[model samples]
Target: MLRRSKRSSSSYYLLRRIALAAKAAKGEQSRCGIVGRSSSCSCSRFLTTGGIDDGEDDHDASTSSSSSTTLIKKRINDEYVDTEAAMERTRMKAAALKAAGLKAESMTVFDREVKRAHRDRAAYLQREKKEEKEKKSSSSEGDFLLEEATRRVLDRLDDIKRPFKRILVIGGATVSTVKQLLEKRRDVETIIACDSSEATLLLVKDIVGDAPKRKFDSFPVEIKYVQAFEDDLPIKDNVVDCVLSVLGLHWVNDLPGAMGQARCTLVPDGLFLSAIFGGDTLTELRIACALAETENEGGVSARVSPLAHVRDAGNLLGRAGLRLPAVDVDTLTLNYKTPMDLVEHLRMMGEQNAVIERRQTIKRSTMELANQKYVENFSALSLSNDDDASMPKPSSSESGISATFQILYMTGWSPSETQQKAKERGSATVSLSDLKSALEEKEEEEEKK
Candidate 1:
């Protein structure tokens, strides 16, 4: 009886091995990357070659003559392999563009914007040290809004529990965020800063110190520079733990597409934060320009690029497949002595007019009239103590005016299993009628109280 039981147990083990091998082979047939079913890829063949399962040869090839289902799987597997190979080749070629290539066809104005941004940033880097000295001497400031917005986003890092091991800062290559990251979180291990211009990355070396990898005192942070377009990121999916964009994403031709790329690059539940100019930005200037141009040229030309509305930011984030998206605005009302002062400040911030439809130059007559209209419409009083007067009057032509900037800060997270999921359709425990009745009862209880 013991000898018979032993024989039966051995037979059962052999059958189980064969069953598992067959099941694995069936699963292998449906997946991508078959590539003519090399022996290494097919489970049945692998098991056969390994001397584990000798009952079956290559399942599809051997069974095709007798089985219709086998022939169909073989055809589907071939197609899947071919499709996967083509996609991989295309993806590699896309990554190659970062070194020397082109933007995607969907990004219409992106190439042009990239060129302008590079030119502007290159000039800034070359003269940054000299300009700082000059700015100090003249008591004039620069890029206050950009730096301020960046720091504000940095302040929220405490809220994120996970360490950002791989960080991608899009369009903020010149402005180094490494120092702040090192100081705030010692968990930073790798920071990949990318921009359209090589010059910006060149200057970043100076800020972050020499070599590709930078060490902040004792902290270890590997920083790499890549010349990449905003819309076309040469990065693998779900590789980066964090993505940050400061005053840059708004310039992309296809904002939604860029956001989608960001979403894909981030790991599950990874953080993405950005601060961009909202539609309300430069309202005074937009209004003044329209009023001036309409009065003079009988129509308005494109003096400034159109900014995105705050209402649309949440929808855009959601469209990009990001979960728990949040959008808010911070209005910065800067006091400039004149409208031209605001223009100079904008130039210093690298915010020169780069829109494709922008006029070569605002007509001198239109420009002067716009300034006059701006002062009349938005100028604030520079209160001064007068010996004879109780209160000061409105600011003169030389007095300060308010230049409004609505910085829209948006935050989103990459999809994760732990995040809340919406209930399936028709699966709700309570019906609409039940919810209405419950609300009515609550309202009645409130009335009694």
Candidate 2:
């Protein structure tokens, strides 16, 4: 009985080994490279020989030894070997991405998935913070820029003096902005708020729905929420009367595609007003990070996401098929007590590095190095009471960190016959030089009179 039990146990063990080997052969395999060791060391022998060694194998008596070995060898050669080769090719491609001093010039610079995750996390944290305080505040400190941008953009809507029945608010919404929009825009019957993060949508829905009494009572606007990316808006084309995005378009990987979609969503002659971070936004931080990473790690990665230049706004509008596009820049410089404060503010704003090839983690030493570099290179003297009023005042510290945010305000209208169109080329009735002379003659005649 004891001899029979031992034989059965050995057979079971042999079968399990075969099963695991077959499974491994069918799936892609990966091994992390250890310090001072090759990642493919253990698999090197198996890979070289093509199959399990006969001396180490304990096969079933009923199975033909040569046939079983041949089957396993074929599986490893066909599936396992090809998978490793493919993985090697991918590694080579990734290595090429690590070239020093190379800018993130590709269209695939930002990872949309990472951006979505960060926004969701940021929204969750913000909600938790508000709950901890047991009060619904108008806005948080990090959201100051967002609220300001929304206010400025919405103010432009007043200049048009037209009623918009349905408005699409791209990006997320804040408490103060929602209140301001509701109280100001009496003609807005519906507001469709779209964002990439589900948590953001839920939080905004709750806050706006539970706003203070009389804040939105008189306006009576219907606020709706949709979860979608900025570049890939899911709404039907030519639906909304207006599309407004504040401090949101900057994160889009394809700004032109996003703008094109926005134009298509607007009704004929509908307004498209937006504010995005310009190219020079956070120039100080970007430089500091680059220098620090180079000094510490012997290479630089995209610590700060790239932004569109103010000059690109007009051209992007033209590409998006919008009419009468106007682009302007608003530079907002803030003085922080420390560089770390600025970083925290960016996190609260849900604007962090989301580059696809970015390092998974930033070392503590690297952050310290970056902070020192930021202070050494970008620190400015605090403005006193006697200083010029136009200049921004820094914190109480002797030397305050300067962080610049360049906001690009863009306004475009959908195509319509009622809108003014430029005349065809060479069809002008008067020449520019002749018109100038006529104006000068008119001025002389007026002087004689």
Candidate 3:
């Protein structure tokens, strides 16, 4: 017999294997009986008549099937491994994020206890000063800022036509706001004065004691004092008709939470009003201190407590579930003979930095350096004309440093069915682009008439 070519022999073996596999897949036969081309098997004759080496063909066919099976298994294992790795990565990332959130929640910004202690200490120091004085000063020189803010706050209350039977005041340490509310507002029958410091709350007791005999005698309104943190009020929900906080709220570490708590005390359609120190309150002092610290210590520490910005006040109110939110600003600049006088004024106001990370004491060298910077950069020869003409005017030749206090006055109302709701978007029949033309046409008609 003639020897077959290597390519033809391999092709014939491949055809024979395909026939065997197909028959096995159909379950026609469990085994193929053809061991070689010479065997008289029916499958051998039908598969291929070409002459070929049986031994080598069997070896090659077995090797090809085993290799294909191994490749398929390897591919399946690779896909499974890839899926497991991705899941592990996702789990690790989720764990890291959860830990980071917990860390952020535990971090302290403004220490409420420290701030309360400072306010209490200030109250005691003021009492000592009063006991030593021969006569009480008629002018509230140290508390003029608070007085101005109080006046503005009351003016806003006056604009509202509705009467408030019950009012809650937070951080009314000076007690001027309470006196004004009792004297002016006939609708106000009960007042709840609250403060973080127990000593500060004690100051409101004078208001309670003198309520019956003073100007409020004409309208006997009940005044009660409560020692409570701004962030955690003791009052029940929807108890007060109006809530007022003057120069407070800024010191709270969790301002949004505190504002929500304040809102919770208000009744439906109740008012939420406050005057907080804006971010620009102590611009000059902040800059001077920052520069001095950077020059001396090669780094800066928290010398001033962070205050809210005018732009953010409205959003904060809405976030606390208040409606009809409004925010405005009132800026005041005070001229100080020296930076030290400014420091003393802050101490009197109990507005010293209570940040948890603040240094215990500022260095004498840094203080001197900051004073130099303040005078050099913010010196004013004469005070600018201000609306509050009662403030002492600087002499034409005298030079002093100026400090700016930007007060943010915010007002928000509790949600109620009676409150006005904004019109839906794209529901207007007229477009603002045509407003000017419409106004012009109306003016023409008016002129013709």
Candidate 4:
């Protein structure tokens, strides 16, 4: 009997272990049975078949046992259902928390990345500004050198001797040159200086001083200042004996019209002498800007235009109806230490103004970036071997702020014998065939090139 009891205990323990294992595999919590004991006695009763002793007692006992068994089975099923439901709720809560944490981390990373980008952009803009200031200083210096060279050349021309009765000086700022010429020519009876700026005329009057004016006696000289545009000199045709201009024609908006007025003002044999700053004045600055834009890999504003260089002054003079026209153009180079210094000189000389239409103020960041790019691209080429290897090198034109310019000096007479002959030939007729031929020729030339 003791051995039989031991075997029964073993069997009960094995059955309980199997039930627990099944519940755990389904993600359910452990639960006690209806018997309120460690072993599953009620479950064992269902597995075994047995008979009753007396009829009435058997009937009552059997019914009671059956009812208890049914109650136990129902309790076990309920316990399993509750355990599974609780586990599912817990799993869902954990997943929600994890998702929220990941979202917060992503937001933090995104904010940091944005801040880093802004800081880098600001740094780039600052670097660009420094470069721009350096470039401007170099440009100004070059301009000063050119102006000085021009002054020297003018002085040489002043030494020549000439006689004149009537003289027209175009452009008013050059009052000093006119004053010197007046002092030299005792025979200059009447002088007219025409210019667009009223302020310039006033300055000229002050510079001329109180030189006595006479009509006919004692080497009479009369200086008259007229406010007029280059294209429309307020003088009658063939009224002046000589027309002279220096460093002013480039300012004229209408070069052709100005030339016509100049020609009309002079007598048939009247002389015309003029000097103009032609296209090559600021080649270095132009080239550096272009190269910098290419290096930066960006587009630049169209406000800057390449200055027009005169290819043939003789042709232009002839087109203006000048006789015995002679055009001579030469290049001049000038240098400066920095761009800012050059700009200051231009201001003093009243040449710092620009004609381009623009906004009153530029974006600080954009300007800074432009300057940096300019310096980075052009600084190396501007250096010279003589520059100290240890010392910091400049960004452009190693010979300080060097600039190249073309000085177009021209001399001619008003419409004379040759001009009259051409006028008499009447307008040269051009037919539709001629127009077609000209267009075809241009296209062929372009293709060949």
By TM-score, who's the top model here? 3
Q: Which ranking of candidates, highest lDDT first?
A: 3, 2, 1, 4
**Comparing 1 and 2 by TM-score, which wins?**
2
Q: How many residue pairs clash in model 2?
A: 0
* Residue 111 local lDDT, model 2: 79
TM-score of every prediction relative to native:
0.65, 0.69, 0.72, 0.49
- Candidate 2: the clashing residue pairs are none
Give all candidate RMSDs, comma-separated.
22.8, 18.2, 33.5, 43.6
lDDT of 3 by residue, 1-449 (tens): 01223553465456547756974674432111121111110011111112223232333332233221110111001100121222343356457767777542254588777787668656655544444452665433325667678888999999999989888888744466776776577788777777776556555453334433225457666655555567655556677999999988888866887788788778899999999999998899889998998998898877888888888998899889889999998877777788877776676567888888778887888888988988899985355336565554332335788888898888999889999998989899988869989999999999999
Give candidate 1's root-mean-square deviation (CA, Å). 22.8
How many clashes would you count in candidate 3? 0
In the range 1-449, model 1's lDDT, one tens digit per residue, is: 00113443355456547756985876543321112111111110110011122223345443433221121132111211122232354467567665465655533543445354534443353445445767789642224555566766776666777678778787742463544565566577777666665445545544545433333456546665544566666556777889988887877777887888888878888898887889988888889989999999999876777778989899889988888889887766666777887775565455655676566666788888888999899875343222212322222334668766787878999999987877879898888999999999999999999
Ranking by TM-score: 3, 2, 1, 4
The segments of candidate 4 whose C-alpha lies over 4 angstroms from its true place after superposition are 1-162, 183-186, 212-220, 292-297, 302-308, 352-399, 418-449
Clash totals, every prediction: 0, 0, 0, 13
Question: By lDDT, is 3 or 4 better?
Answer: 3
The lDDT of each candidate is 0.61, 0.65, 0.66, 0.47
* Pairs of residues at least 3 apart in sequence or in different chains that clash in candidate 1: none
TM-score of 2: 0.69
**What's model 4's TM-score?**
0.49
